[model samples]
Target: MSATPAGSAGAGDGVYRTGYFETRLAADPNRAVVWRHICDYLRRWIPADSDVLELGAGWCDFANAVAARSVTAMDLDATVLKAAHAGVTAIVGDCTDLSRFGDGSFDCVLASNLLEHLERADAERLLHEARRVLRPGGRLLLIQPNFRLNPKEYFDDYTHVAIYTDRSLTDLLTSLGWHVEHTFARFLPLTMKSRGSRLSFLVPWYLRSPIKPLAGQMLVVASNPAR
Candidate 1:
C-alpha cells in the first residue's frame, strides 16, 4: 500500500484504528467467500449510474466490483487508500464527520464491517452523517458482524470493537429517522460444534424471513425518509 495526504484521524492507535483488509498478510478462504457475497449484493442493488460513498474502504475491492459512475472510497489510513484502484478516489477521512462534503452529497453510502469498530455513540453519529450526505430517498447499505456467529472466528480480528444484533441495529436506524427497507444476514457463521453442516444456507433464509430475532452479520438497507 502506498501513501496519501493524511487527514484528521491519526495513524496507528491500535484500537478502532486498524484496517482488517490492510493488515491481513494472506487471504483467508472463508473471509474471501464473505467478500464475494458482499460484492454480489452490491452489484444487484447498486445501479451502474449511482454515485457511492464507501466508508472504511480498506482496499477498494468493493469499489472495483460495483460499476458505479463515481465512488469516493474514504478511510483513515493513507497507506491503505493508496492501494485503491483507478475508479475509486481514495480519500483519507473519518466516517463519523462528513463536513468535507455538503448535504445530500451522495446517492448511496456503504459501510461494511465498519460499525463494530465504533463505539455505540460514534456508530449512531456515523449513521446520522450517512443520512446527512445521502440524497433524498438515497440508500444506506450497512453490513455488520453478527454476535451469534462464533466470536473466535469473526471477532478475533484485533480491530473489532463490539458485537451487534439485528433488532438493536434496525431500531438504531429507525431511531435515526431512516426507514429500513431491507434487513438480511450474510456470511457463514463459524461454529465449533458442526463444521460441515448446511446451516450456512439457513442463515440467509432466516435473514430473508427471520424466525429468530438475531443473526451473524446483519445487512441493513435503509432509505432516507421522504421529507
Candidate 2:
C-alpha cells in the first residue's frame, strides 16, 4: 500500500489519547488473546495467503493475530505504529479515504468496532472504499456492536455517531454492491472491557455455540462481486 495524506476530520487523535483505551479498553493482554481465537474462527472466510487490511486497527489486535500473507493496519491515531507487530505495516490516516491503496490491492478488508465511530455518510464511504480496494471475490469482514441488541449501551462510546443492526448493515453493504455472504447477529460480547471478554479461552466455544449468552456484537461478511 502507498502512503496518503492524513487529516480527514473524523475522530481525531485526542480521543484515543484521552483515557479511551486506557480506561475503557484496559484489557490489552486479554484482548490480544481473544483476538487470536477470533482470528482462528475467522479463517473460514479469510485465507492464510490473502493480503489483509484492517481499518481503525486500534492496538492492531486483529492485524497482528490474523494469518495473512500481508497485513496493513490503518488508524487515525499514530499509536497504531507502536501496536503493530513485526510483519504488519501501520498507517495513520482516515479510514473513509483509502486512496493510498490501489484498486484490488487486498484480498480482505476488516473493520471491527469501527463503522459506528463514523457518521452514516462516512460509514458508507468507508465501505465503498473498502470494496474498491479489494480484489474481485475478496471479502469484507465487520464485527460491530448491534444497536438492536444493545440499544442502551450502543451510545456508551462518545465517538459513536451512527448505529447499525445486522439488517441495516446488510442493506448498506448491498447498496454499495457487495454480496452479503454471512450474518451472525450475536457473535461476541458488546465490549471487550467486560469480564466476559476476559474469559478468552471460552471464545472458541462461544463462537461455535448455538446460543450466545451475552452477545451484543454482530459479524457481517460480504464479498466483492466480479465486475
CA lDDT of every candidate: 0.66, 0.85
Q: Write the per-residue lDDT of candidate 2 for residues 111-209, one digit (tens) a residue.
A: 898888777777888888998999999999999999989999888886677789999999989988999999999999897666666788988999999
| Pairs clashing within candidate 1 | 146-216
Q: Model 2 segments beyond 4 Å from truth? A: 1-13
Q: Looking at candidate 2, what is the lDDT of residue 28?
A: 69
Please give the range of 10 consecutive residues that has the lowest summed lDDT in model 1. Answer: 1-10
TM-score for each model: 0.75, 0.93
Q: Write the per-residue lDDT of candidate 1 for residues 80-184, one digit (tens) a residue.
A: 456567868888766787889899888899987788777777788788888999999889988777775545566666555667767777888998999999876
lDDT of 1 at 114: 82
